[model samples]
Target: MLTIGVLQMTSGVDPEANLAVIEDAAKRCAKRGALMLFTPEMSLLLDRDRARARAWIESDAPDRVIESLSVIAAKQHLDIVVGSIPVAAGGGKWANRTHYFHPDLGPPVTYDKTHMFDVDLASGESWRESNAYEPGREVVTVEDTPLGRLGLTICYDLRFPALFGALGDRRCDAIAVPAAFTRPTGAAHWHVMLRARAIEAQAFVIAAAQVGRHEDGRETYGHSLVVDPWGEVLLDMGGDAPGLGFCDIDLGRIREVRAQVPALANRREIAKS
Candidate 1:
């Protein structure tokens, strides 16, 4: 069984403050014998003001948030996944990227968020992420860990099915979904969407999330989750509080479930009319 820790947080615009909390949590996870720690989206900062965000976010040097965790991972000999960081993507834009770090690895594995949360809600919450960030054109997945192959994806990507399907096809044992979900949408769709993904892919789904209100006055619905291949929620960390959640997984379950169902192999392309 692979032991994993999911860290739920409510971050602000200050990178230092966020790092303080995350670094401590990483140590705890390491001490508890967790093989890896997964964090939520925008693990560094979540600033609402575009000007302030651009002024504070950087691309010229390594992000302090990721750097600190990288050092911790090496020091403690742990593995970590920072859900997403808003790094300067040139031309006054940013890329919401995920970083997977290992104690022995030189550089953290990266996955820029592919789907942007561009929507207008009926409850007066409107976001235009494209205004400040550029979308990633490629999909990324890694397959060399104790937990078997795993696919990495950020918040908005959860709503899209095709991405998860493609990962399922690749025989991933688990999928990482880290998010900073808005309160309204999360309350309505969070649990269902997460369970659906696990059921559809027949893979373990691990999601760490941001919760509560931030310095920007925006609120997020937080319920960090871990689902088994049978789509049963093994863990659900409650809303808005910072803490660590654990799940002990057997990777062999993925193969057993797939063997009985065999959905991926049964899939066929549709014929054009």
Candidate 2:
């Protein structure tokens, strides 16, 4: 069994303040004997104001936030999945990117969020993420982690199954789905969808989520979760506040589930009409 820590955060516009929270969590995670820690989407900054956010987003080069996280990972001797951060992707656009930092690895493995959240909701909240963010093109997975082969996905990508199917095809032992879901949509579909994804992929799903109201004037549904291959929810951090939660993942369960169901092995593609 591998123990991992998930940080449910109420991040703000200030990257420094957000980093402090993460640093504290890393210390606690290390003390608790967790080998890896996972954080929520927009872990550094959650500003909706493009003008104000532009100053913090960096292109190509390692930004201050990334550098800080790298140091934290090395210092704590803990692998960290910084759920997602905003980085300049050229053409006046940014990428919602995930950075996986390992203590021994010099540079982090990165994955940009594939699907963009472009919607006009009935709650009168409209988000056109494509306007300011570029979409990622490739499916990304990290090999030989504490959870075995781990796949990466961000907030909006959870709504799409093809991505998860590709991850399942790759035979990922675990998938990280860090998110910052809106209150309305999160309340309606969060638990069910996450549970379904875990069962479908036959892989452990670790989702560290944003929670409560933020300094940027938006609210998010928390409920950071860890689900097993059998669709059992191992941990649910609840929707009330932000904190660090830990879950013990039994890697052997992956083999057991696959042997019983053989979903990934039995999967056959249906021809398009």
Candidate 3:
């Protein structure tokens, strides 16, 4: 069994402050025998203003945040997956990018978010992510752990079933869904959707999330979770304070579940009308 840790945090605008908390959580997780650690989207900073975000966000790959995270991962000898960072993608657009790092790897493999949350919520929480960011084109999967293949995705991507299907088709043993889901939607659909994905894909789901109110006064749902292929929630951080949750997993269960259900082979192309 492999131990995975999910870090739930409430981050503000200061990268330094955020890193301090994250590093502390990493140490705690490492102490608990976690070989892999995952953090939420906007792990470094959470700001409502796009222009202000561009000021601290970087265009190059090796920014202060990424560099610091790389050093942390190397020092801890932990496989780290940090949720979306606002990457300067030119023309005043930032890419919501995810980073996967290994202890001995030179640099992390970046995964830009393909799905943007462009809807207006019932609570009047409106997000025009496309207004400030560019969408990614490819799905990224890497294998560095005993857990086999791992796929990466960001917040809004959770709503789309096809993305998970693509990941499952690639024989991904687990999917990392790092999110900063707003309060209303998260209260309603978060648990259901996450569990559905876990059951359908027959893969372990690790979702580290941003919770509580931000400096921008935006309230987030803070139930960071880890679910198994059988749709069992292993750990759930209930509030805004930074915390880590562990889940012991046997990857062989993935094969056993998939074979018993045989869902992946059940897909069929539909005839066009």
Highest TM-score scorer: 2
How many clashes would you count in candidate 1? 0
TM-score of each: 0.96, 0.98, 0.95
Regions more than 4 Å wrong, model 3: 58-62
lDDT tens readout by residue for model 1, 1-273? 878999999889888888877788888987889998889998888788888777677644346656777898888777888898888887868899999888885688889888888899989999999888888877788768657787999999999999999888887888999999998899999999999999888999999999988899999999999998878999999994878888898888888888888888898877889
lDDT-wise, the better of 1 and 3 is 1
Write down the RMSD of all candidates, one decimal each: 1.4, 1.2, 1.6
Whole-model lDDT per candidate: 0.87, 0.94, 0.85
Task: Report how far off residue 66 is in candidate 2 (Å).
Answer: 1.1
Q: Quick one: best lDDT, which candidate?
A: 2
lDDT of 3 at 258: 83
Please identify model 1 stretches exceeding 4 Å from their true place: 59-62
Q: What is candidate 2's lDDT per residue for 117-204, written digit by digit as tens?
A: 9999899999999999999999999999989999999988999999999999999999999999999999999999999999999999
TM-score for candidate 3, please give it: 0.95
The alpha-carbon root-mean-square deviation between model 2 and the true structure, to one decimal in Å, is 1.2
